[model samples]
Target: KTIFPPEGRHWSILEEKFLALVAEGKVFFGKNGESQPGLIRYLSEVEGLVPWTWWPHEEVGHTDESKKEIQQLFGKSAAFDTPKPERLIKRVLEIATNPGDLVLDSFAGSGTTGAVAHKMGRRWIMVELGDHARTLVAPRLQGVIDNEDRGGVTEATAWKGGGGYRYFRLAPSLLEYDKWGREVVSKAYNSAMLAEALCKLEGFTYAPSETEYWNHGHSTEHDYLYVTTQTLTHEQLRDLSEQVGEGRTLLVMCAAYRGDARSLPNLTVKKIPDHVRDRCEWGRDDYSLEISALPMAAEPKPDDVDLFGAPAK
Candidate 1:
């Protein structure tokens, strides 16, 4: 199986391995002893059906066609250089996923993955750092939801979109450092906001009990989280420990505590600055590059400016 005559050398690694496979009847050498056989049976064909590994021009699609699809939807020249064809995305989704599967695209360019997933009845999370996330992505998704978007596999899939998706912007950090490099709770957070933040941080649901001031939220039925900006004394800790009851454990997040909080078995007191200092990259909440800044509208020419209500001149 060597490219050169076997008289000089044994087969190369590829040829040696292939010849070995032939010996094991896994690959077929031609009946007439052809040098390189056409057939390599890696696996038994499923009902003699083979999926096309190579795509024709139509299946994979070209750049021009992709641009056309974009133009049909957006009704203008696309801002992107190479937006993927909807057909290509649909094909990939068909092969790689099933209905109701969750798809995540971190680099969602023109929101094609999300659009395709939506049409295909898949849940998707699309994250884009550019202005397109607000302008392009959000609008495209809204169109899909309203069944107003006609382009990109819509007709082929019989997609009459009727689904819901929630959009959320990342909240700013809850803790930051000051000029003295001392960590403190963010001034942006109020008492209620601080409580909700602490609930999330401590792995508890943000469900404040109406009957109990200390019961901000719960990790379990008996384990509760309480967040306060006030510094606590030993007397306050003792009182809280006693009030927490026999079976309950109270995790109190405060600005400061005077006594050894671990002394009480039922009470676990964590100081705010110390507890959440290393939890996140403090004060560095907005990580997005925001690739495209908002475009300013072109200023109107003197002649083009409206002057219907102007005084006679």
Candidate 2:
């Protein structure tokens, strides 16, 4: 129905458009019957907006391609079953966020989210609970930063990379329940960590004072917090009340208290463990990735010197 006879095609409505194409040899006739019009247009350019509702299976890539991408970077022998293709992540990033936006991956297995985000110029955070975080994610990100990683979207994105990222480990828990179900401060906490834990619990910053033993930190200049494991007696409380003076408030967190805390108008006393135990899900250790189930080098001892033994330069 779109095709028209010569007279119909030459009508003023259609002639202007067709005459130019005919003159330019852009129009053509059917193979056997020279009367009917053949395909007139040249090849079309690639579509700008390809609907995501249905992409050709070939364009979206397959599981095999994803594995190949990882293998290319890690090596032929190294493979991960759940690695996501960078192209898919790239598509998501393109649609969702802009450059320099922060992306977080809580369960960062092989660091693909971090890798793809880094390649696309987005800031990223990847938290992995296994020791493979050290063996896999860190090295993979480092490779991406150094441009040493030539696989994944490198060819498609032309990612001659340049960027940086920092690594950090979570601190141990501050409290735990004993076998008898008594709440106790974690054995792993050092003096400073204990102080920091108390500061966090009491809603104070951990700013220790050089001159004042009682001034661990403060919520305001008029209100301060003190944290200690020592049992506080009435005499100690009286001394602390005098130190706090007339207008200031002092919140003391201790293992045990023997004083009438209410007698001191500006002082508040809280028992540690008893007050803090129910505050959080205690004893939850944040561990880095392990490449294998086998034991790693024994966890470094607190007082033990360097395993390498050589002094720092």
Candidate 3:
């Protein structure tokens, strides 16, 4: 509108849409309970439409259709043994979830879940450790963006293709040892990981500054948090405070600190181990239920005992 405004800077398609929505009795606050643009309920009324679970392949697509979809998206070479038809996924979404709900596919095979979710206007997270994550999923998603591959629920959903996605290469899960001893954590929380965790814990955004050493995250523009494994001395804290200066406040989480931490109002100092310990269950590896030892069952006396070690009937 900024580039192609017919009525100079006074025209807005949003205003027209709002008026049209008002006439249609659909304009209201967004799902987040805010009367904001973009999020505001527009023409989409099929959000939580519950479809039946007993869907036949005739209604949705069958395994043949799934293979056809793969061929259309990728190629004949991308023949999956049990490919999920897009219509099947659509029905699943209709039955289980509402639009805008998050869908997680742990093993994204041919990235069917993600593709369907994208078309159906649902947020999705696809975790794929295999080679196809890059070769198949990436290309498929790019096709979704370019509005090329129009098989499956594409026609049903009328997907115009305008959303963006982020791709992350996660570190492989490995056993990690802490300073105390060899302990098993699912994934070792490094310094950055610790900082990110602490930031979320303290209700701050995990945004590390490139230039500044102290700024790890921030709740507000002026308020920041710094996480470290080293024990901070009073002198160090003083230097930090000086660096931070007035107006801005910093939350410093470390292993240990000497002298009074409450001396500086700007720097809120906290110990890492105790607080972090409270956040998680660590140290012990064994997580099984402990079976208590029972005393040996007393032998029955001759007077009470029967033929089969029971009282006579």
TM-score of each: 0.69, 0.64, 0.60
Better of 2 and 3 by TM-score: 2
Q: Taking the tens digit of each residue's C-alpha lDDT, what string does model 2 give over 32-65? A: 5464543344336222343476645466566788
Q: Indicate which candidate wins on lDDT.
A: 1
Put down candidate 3 lDDT per residue, 140-238, tens digits, no spaces. Answer: 998887888788898899998878799988653323556766433324678888788778777999999999899999999999999988888999999
Q: Local distance difference test, per candidate?
A: 0.79, 0.78, 0.77
Q: Model 1: clashing residue pairs? A: none
Which sections of candidate 3 miss by over 4 Å? 1-54, 95-107, 129-131, 169-175, 178-201, 206-212, 280-313
| Model 3 alpha-carbon miss at residue 201, Å | 5.0
Give per-residue CA lDDT, model 1, range 139-178, as digits (tens).
8899899999988789988999899788877667788779
Query: Which candidate comes out best when scored by TM-score?
Result: 1
Ranking by TM-score: 1, 2, 3
| Candidate 2 clashing pairs, residues 3+ apart or interchain | 130-288, 130-289, 130-290, 131-288, 131-289, 131-290, 132-289, 132-290
Predict model 1's lDDT versus the native.
Answer: 0.79
- Over 4 Å off, model 2: 1-51, 55-57, 76-78, 155-163, 219-223, 246-248, 281-313
Model 3: worst 10 consecutive residues (lDDT sum)? 303-312
